[model samples]
Target chain A: MTIGSQVKQSLANMKAIHATLQQLALTSTNEEAQRAFHEAMLETEQMIAALKGRISTLEREEPQYKGM
Target chain B: MPAWLEVAIRSICILIGLFIITKLLGKKQLSKLSFFEYIVGITIGDIAGTMSMDLDIRLTEGVTSILIWALFPVAISHISLRSKKFRDFVEGNSTVFIKNGKILEDNLKKEKYTADELLEQLRKKDVFRVADVEFATLEANGDLSILLKRDKQPLTIGDIKPYVPEEKEPQTVIMDGKILDEPLATARLNRGWLKQQLDQMGVAIENVFLAQVDSYGQLTVDLYDDRIQLPEPQQKQLLLASMKKAEADFELFSLQTNDAEAKQMYEQQAKHMQQLIQKLQPFLM
Candidate 1:
């Protein structure tokens, strides 16, 4: 509902996608598919880290939105 | 010219004429032919046969007759294209044989289609039960098109609301021990990649009978020697299973977590993961 909650929801989805991609990377027999999934997982991890930073900045700017 | 030589020349001439006429007529004759087109075809063949053997009829006369027969059909088709009424008249209207799960005996009699014939056509379509058919029609091309009852219809992608990834046509990268460069390029792969894959599989290029690269980038090979077996590709299945397991783990985490926020996040993530699995199911399965 709130911007913080929205961000948290997005973060959750990103984490799930990342986990799925990591699983695929580990389990895939095809070399190209494995490499692709691994790369996508790394990219998603960076995005998750970036989103976490955004959430921290939001928390500092709007204290009411923090821990909500 | 000798008598035998004359007949040989005539036959060759008729054969060439038939080829040219058929080419000019286009692919319409290759598909279902209308009754008129069928009659014209038989007449042309008869004329060609007579002209080839019977020296009494001049070759020019036979050619003229065949040309008239071919031209009239072409002209009729061109006219039929411009006029819906004329097209219906020329091709004949598609007759309905069944409606609302009921066989129309009057329509069947009009089309002179016997019950056995109708049953045979339905069987060819793999529909054994006439009760399952909601509507059936005899197309102008003589094809029996049938629609099964709503409850009898097979499940399709639309029935299940899942996001299905579009699949590209697979490329035949190898055939008869020869690597096709064009198809490999179409598949966005190179000879080096193919060689490496073949090497990994312990299969030589020369020993491969056929090989295809699917949308998932999985290469499947049929070997010249049928005795040897290659392991089936299971990357899709493995990926799907892993995703399912991850989804189950998230659900379990949601159940076990004490913090309300963490529990909510896990539940939402599990739901999202389930959606992703649904999206990928069509391709993976």
Candidate 2:
């Protein structure tokens, strides 16, 4: 698979993981468990955001890539 | 046991090997490298670094790893160049975020870009208003390519100037005292005509440094000695005739065009050309 597609797939995976973590954070009775899940979800969201930025960067460079 | 000497020799070998491999790879700058290539470069550098300093690993083992890392990227790059599918897989496709002054919401969502970010990008392109953009694409390299709407685009010489001269490409007839046959043919002139021109300028073909014929069939010759000065002749009649033809064409366009804006533009052009002709009348006399 292309690096771009892999990054996109990773982004999707991260989003799914983030949604699950959010749900877990809400359902957890223990305050510590809830906080940890929330933190993990935030980190996953950040990763997804970074992946989106990477995809945009790759898309922008395509014309030069074609010339190469 | 002089283990230090062996380590030093191994380090030198690794350095030389990495240098040669790097030179073998084409001179694509780090900034120009795609994400995959960038990762490959880092991996290769890491392998080289491990080989250079680590005494625990066998020198041959490290060198082999380095070669594999470097050659794999080169091979992939070759394959990518040969296959469009491979290239597309390696580099994602660019998406159009805006088309015909309308924001492509679906595409924006797919790209995970917010409408506010799109507006910011448009602003960076000097497009203050979204309505002014005809098309805006988010390229794979993260660049925003924008085309302004027709009416919003900056005016060119053709928009205001009455006379739009015919587009003609210049042809080189001679270079370094040697007459190029292909350019001469492209210019639709023979050696005889070239020789005649050279004779008119009192220059021999062997002494001519460069000679080019412009679209208007005007010849400019430069000599190797740089002593000769060629006088440029101004033809008042040619200019007057072209002006008159342009005035007539604009008047004709104004009559035939049904588009209000185009008709108005043509009328204004005709008026401008008429004024130009009047100003040139004294010069013609």
Q: Which one is best on TM-score? A: 1
What is candidate 2's lDDT per residue for B56-160, written digit by digit as tens?
A: 888778777887888887888889889999988877678998887888999999989998898889888788899899898988767889999999999996787
Chain A TM-score for predicted structure 2? 0.83
Q: Global lDDT for candidate 1?
A: 0.80
Error of 2 at A67 (Å): 70
lDDT of 1 by residue, B152-246 (tens): 99998777855545556788999999999998887777898899889989999999999998866678999999999899877667667766765
lDDT of each: 0.80, 0.70
Off by over 4 Å in 2: A1-68, B1-85, B104-126, B154-168, B176-178, B188-190, B202-209, B215-217, B222-285
True contacts kept of each: 0.00, 0.00
Q: What is the lDDT of residue A17 in candidate 2?
A: 51
lDDT for A31 in candidate 2 is: 51
Return the lDDT, model 1, position A45: 70
